[model samples]
Target: MSPNPPSSRALPPLVRIEGVTRRFGDTVALDGVDLDVRAGEFFALLGPSGCGKTTLLRVLAGFETPDSGTVSLDGRDLRGVPAHRRPVNLMFQSYALFPHMSVEKNVAYGLARERLPRAEIRERVAAVLATVGLTAQARRRPHQLSGGQRQRVALARAIVKRPRLLLLDEPLSALDKNVRAEMQLELKRLQLEAGITFLVVTHDQEEAMSLADRIAVLDRGRILQVDTPVELYRHPQGRFVAGFVGSNNIFSGHLLPSGGLDVPGVGVLPAPVGVGSAAGLVAVAVRPESIQVAAADAKGGEGLLHGTVLDVSFHGGSSRIAVTVPALESPVLVTASGPATVTAGTPVALSWDPSSAVLVETEETTWKTGGQAT
Candidate 1:
């Protein structure tokens, strides 16, 4: 028998923010931001500091109210819904577990507020604690557990209440790298098992990329782009999206009439697509891996630009080379699969496929002083 296909229904969004704006005195923290969290999907809000990521999270948790918008949960307008009354739970950056309360008490606190039968509360708390792998340490207090353990306890407590929507505010920021990786997996598993909508706010791009089904890249109170991690990486809409999501080497040149761009020393690069400009300033964005470096004067290759190796850094499994092309004002970055074959002050040539480079429109009138194109 064929396996049953997943059901399709116009399931209402678990969380929705419409025309949300938050201001602290004269400083606008969020500006007409709109977002949606589909049921049972892991969605992430990603941005740098002062970009309004956290402020948006606060609005969804009912910790803060929008000056001129509505926050809704499952199609119900949530205006004036106090934090405690809303069917949403927030996992804070600090984890915020009570120091005096044991793991069991911490998880049972919310259930007790609801006054469930004692047996049912105990059973539910036990199940949640086990789900987070903290059942063995039920009697332990916050001080006795490690950072990861404390975080899991916080997760257990938030989940025990079984809220329809779960909000996580940088939930794994404090753990060590290895522990954070493990928790990322665990959190995904728990979210799958629980089948509730999860909306996370984080500045760590890697975390957001790994954990989210889709990401909304925010900046200065505005969402610049929203798409899957792969889509954002492979086909960024603009220079900002390309540079922000990952490392990119950018070069500035003018589009030529022959469907190619002329770099002073790099020669004409045929445009991958019809650019339709003869002398307009343009920026070319390419990832380090896209640029291939070889010994200077390597014969029989198209799109070659010769340069001197200004610096090289070995970063385990791959090496980064900073090459300075004479015509370009700054050095271009290229990543080799293994250790560098050419040392500093040595000559090298860089070549890349026409398809690998993305032409961008420059926003800044003058390039920055350093070699950094971003």
Candidate 2:
């Protein structure tokens, strides 16, 4: 799903989470977290497993109660709100559907429970099934449908109620790669068509980056960063975010007077002037795509670092080259465009623009309400 940027922090909030902390025995699932999701936006909680993303979603869904803090939805406090009463719906990764029920029945189950009129239930179910492209399979049982179809059925059921907020937990993780790709687009289309606020929880970075306009990155029960996909990619705040979001070549050492990293053995790496402290321990992170690599003998003033190409992988439009520099503990990865030009075992020189080198904190930082990085 492509990102649709929210209006601003000033926009009316649909979900307000403040200092919500939940504990299961001695384990702290959520660590004094504060988040605000704007109305009509597709937001994502992105993190690795056991990072409290799911726990936060459950709190908002009213399935789990927080030990401390409060959760408000559309200016209404949800302290005593039951899961069924709240204007919220959760779509699980398993896509739980009644095995004996037909597609239309599954979609109509919620409305039926509310004892709505038969005609109204039918009309709403049919409209939702059509929205998810499942009108043709409305009569099929759960087992008769494909994995993607069952997923669509679950989604249709959730949105048929026209809930104010729809929560999806690893929505497309079960499907095959091809089907997952198709469903991503389908899910976004459904969100726009239904005009429902979506809060998706996924550990897949690419999934969050592709689907959410704003992503809240969580780790160890804390939100490390929240920003647009491009901002998080190009301007990650610290080492954890830089390493987690994508491949980054990091050079760690003392900071020089001219804003360059003074490595003990790898030599100085470039950085923009006035980046950080004049002299102190620091690290410079450079993306693989930003690094320029060429045959060692291929001129251009002795490049920044010299290494031997350890491996080269062709990825259709791009090539991944791993170069082993003797001074660094890990190999430096370079994402060169097009097919491979340099082969393994060949000595190569790597150089990147000074401005591309970002000085990232060695420790994780917290993301607050003022749009500060972590």
Candidate 3:
């Protein structure tokens, strides 16, 4: 499957959150947050702890009420809806499966709660189990199943009722690295096949990038930016997002007369397009993989920044090289494919396409915090 959701902007949103605010005594959990989850869209709330992502998820599931603002599903205000009354299912981080019950029984538990017919429950349970590739494990208890299997069972249980929306909190946190990778693909497939709007809350950036069609980056109970993963990574609007979403070689400088950024130690580097004259400090984030490293003695004058190789580590198909330059406070990280021929203390030259860099303003005035500003 493609790594993005299909364009469906003309369609109405399935979930809408506007001016939502929730607080915990002295602390604000959500600050005037606004968002839209399109129908059949895989959306993610991504941020660090205490960012109010989980709190917002709870609000959607009817487990928590906003102190102010409104939340609606399909244009219907969900003001007084209780957790059990909402047409949404929340799959917790723990999976929360019944230890003694078999997978099939666990999957059918939700259906039974609605007092559905036994044959229909069996049919739905079996169908979902097959969809999740867990038909063979249908009779296995929670303890007898693997971490990934148990997760699938939890998912099956949540989806068996065929809720209009699915809320997953750290859904793959319990699985191992290999299994987690596998489940990422499975989750995406299931979301598409079931045609359910999924709103997942995760602290893992890669998880959000890989799974969501659009991601809302949250901080301190505020939604900072909501965009597709590629857009968030390639074109972050501010310093926090540039540093948060991915590794970047950041340099704080001021705009030069020629529209370039005069980095203190690295000299003037080409500024990204659309970065008009901003009076204050401007920070540029250059992706590690976008940089080209060559021997210092190489015949390149323009667009070249010299540095000393501090370290290099091989990571399967790619190698991460740390280079210490004169002006930058931190060593710039460059990801070069294959093995690195450079050694520690070796002089190196780095060059990148001018367009590869992204301009981000660091002025406090533009900084978004406390969910008060978007």
Q: For candidate 1, lDDT tens digit of each residue in 149-212?
A: 9989999899999999999999999999999999998888898888777889998888888888
The TM-scores, one per candidate, come to 0.89, 0.94, 0.93
lDDT value for model 1: 0.81
lDDT by residue (1-374, candidate 3, tens digit) is 22455566667999999999999999999999999989988999999988999999999999898999999998999999888988899999999899989999999988898899999999999999999999999998999988988999999999989999999999999899999999999999999999898999999898999999889999998888989898898888776787788787777777666666776545777676567566766677788999898886533443367778999999999999998776556788889989998988888888888788777656534321111001
Task: Show model 3 residue runs off by greater than 4 Å.
Answer: 1-3, 297-303, 362-374
List the pairs of residues colliding in candidate 1: none
Q: Better model by TM-score, 1 or 3? A: 3
Candidate 2 local Cα displacement, residue 322, angstroms? 0.5
Candidate lDDT (C-alpha), each: 0.81, 0.86, 0.85
List ranges where model 2 is wrong by over 4 Å: 1-10, 297-301, 362-374
Model 1 residue 29 CA deviation in Å? 1.4
The full ranking of all candidates by lDDT, starting with the best, is 2, 3, 1
Model 2 worst lDDT run, 10 consecutive residues? 365-374
lDDT of 2: 0.86
